[model samples]
Target: MILGLSKHPSDESIVEGILAGGRKEHEALVALYKKFHVSLERFIIHRSTGRDYAKQPEDIIWEAIEAFVVNVKKGSFTLKDATLETYLKSICKNLWFRYISQEASREERQNKYMAEWDKLEDDVSDMLIEKENWENYINLVNKLGKNCKQILDMRLIEGLSMQEISQKLIANGTFENDQTVRNAKSKCLKKIMELITSNHQ
Candidate 1:
């Protein structure tokens, strides 16, 4: 039989039951979670910064509770210095840090993939337009000068807005402003077209 509890059990008793494991362990952890879940969820929501992450507040709370139970059973939680709530918060905080780091890395990889895809778009444009003479088209595009290459790569291939490209170029001292970026794009497209026509002939 499980130990008796008139109402709220002491934290120490709950911890001991969990450490003992089996039916009593389940009862103790459930009781602990029921007693503190609302507060823990509130804490997670407050800390999540209005961003939906790998888990919702409730999910994080439950996961943390489960981990706490296991750790208590394994003797990893001494529970001598801090309250149970404090330890639970620590676990939740660690989860948030891990989620944020993973999200950042995922975003970085997506940006890199997008950049590469944009470059490929430029490389394959000619092939898409002139299926029969794709080889000649590719050869002609390869012969474009460095300036044309850069202009098209940024404007067409990279999918950057003209204003964005303009700011970047101006910052790099490549051009004076947005108008220059536009003019350069026009010239580059004209040159590429000329190369394609001449190669066709």
Candidate 2:
């Protein structure tokens, strides 16, 4: 009936077709879209009624389908107690929630960065009386210890969050946690202030 295939292919057959690849994979994907697209679209629209999604409902459904196909091919999707429909819906929900969380987190970080930058400028301006003194301040920042310099550069120059900096440091076994990065960044700022004050004295 659909794509010259049976009216309803069993879930096992669909999985097999997808794993087999080539024309079978293409047919399987088409069949899946035909079977579940409307229901999934309704579900997504219902769940995301008031939300501001960057992607449209159709786009999300397609993305979910692609993710499902990829997961099946990768052996990540094991239809145990749940049906294929259930699994696909779960993926769609998770993707949407993750997108929302990331957008919220990005906004939060931008706001925090702006506030911190404003305070930093105010503090530095008060300390550095002349243009040359500002140059001295930059030199002082560079003269900080390796960890301090890297953390400041990541935070100030690269605009990375403390959590992001922590992850990078943890990968290389430099620092343990975000709290540690926070402590180090604070110390770096204090050290700069001390150096600036001493220069004036």
Candidate 3:
């Protein structure tokens, strides 16, 4: 049994302990995980059919628990209408659905990026074919940043999908997640276009 916790702590107490933070917070988070992880895992696995989850059910549940902790601390979660378990499950479901939605849109996003690249290539076909101009263009891309250059190289040169670039960036500890990768890619592409336009001018 965890010290400073009752045999069966009330939901209110658990919430209070989590908000209080420190040791109480730690204990409360452990308690919450112990109480809900299995149920949430089962919930996730049951709904995971035909979905490509980047994380396992256990990882997703733990991620949900961590998000719940942050929400509770930030007053985003209040145990007013729903029990802790119900509220947590809601968070898990929302997170799962959002992840799936992102996965579903990946192909569409990849096509859009490819179309944009194709248009850019058409616009600068003459310049791009010249060796010196191509080198200068690459130099402009390299100025964006290490990660930006890598992302563009993978997406544009290697023709990798955004999801693939996201995984690589995350693995390298360059970006936090796929959404961040998308944002960075968009910005990098825009910057490249501006640079190319200015360079030609």
Candidate 4:
């Protein structure tokens, strides 16, 4: 059933297939998956804590390939922006983020999904432990002063651009100017980084 996960093949051929953006493009994408899946899976397996995620690395690879093909088709990206390796790696990273986000969302939506799915308890425990450890660190940050927390929160959590945050804070009268907020932000972040780096659970 699997086709490509065995070799890198010719990069030019793969790139050409991707640039084609049609049925052949899909097939070449599939071929690229078959070529890279095993190696990628092995790479993730070494790092993924023996979870089922390691079992589905190819799915992530395919998602990345599909998204990349769509981007190429839609003119969202050009071949000039990247080589095959850079493009594929960026796709893989984005796919991993999406996969993780979806997985987390699903778990939150169906807390008992695992209980019904027939997985080992120890594996579930491992997931829970990692989740709890991360939450604890977040809780530590929650203990920060409100302004310090808000600065980090806007920039890091809300994913706001620094310029945007500067404008927003000035509008709200949080500081006299944008540079003031930026300076305050740098100090708070450095302090929090030091705190968490030294005291992370």
Candidate 3: regions farther than 4 A off? 6-8, 50-52, 108-201
Q: Which ten residues in a row have the lowest lDDT in candidate 3?
A: 122-131
| lDDT agreement with native, every candidate | 0.73, 0.77, 0.79, 0.64
Clashes, model 2: 0
Pitting candidate 2 against candidate 4, the one with the higher lDDT is 2
Cand. 4 TM to true fold: 0.41
Query: Model 2 Cα displacement at 157 (Å)?
Result: 29
User: For each candidate, C-alpha RMSD in Å?
Assistant: 13.1, 9.4, 8.1, 18.1
lDDT of 4: 0.64
The stretch of ten residues in a row with the least summed lDDT in candidate 1 is 119-128
Expressed as tens digits, the lDDT of each residue in 1-201 for candidate 1 is 224775677788789878777888888877788778888888877876796676677777777888887788677887785789899889887876677778889989867855664555454565436556545644665688666677667765577776787788888898887667766766666677666656556
TM-score of each: 0.59, 0.51, 0.52, 0.41
Pairwise lDDT winner, candidates 3 and 4 = 3
Model 3, TM vs. native: 0.52
Query: Which regions of candidate 2 fall more than 4 Å away from where they truly are?
Result: 1-3, 113-201
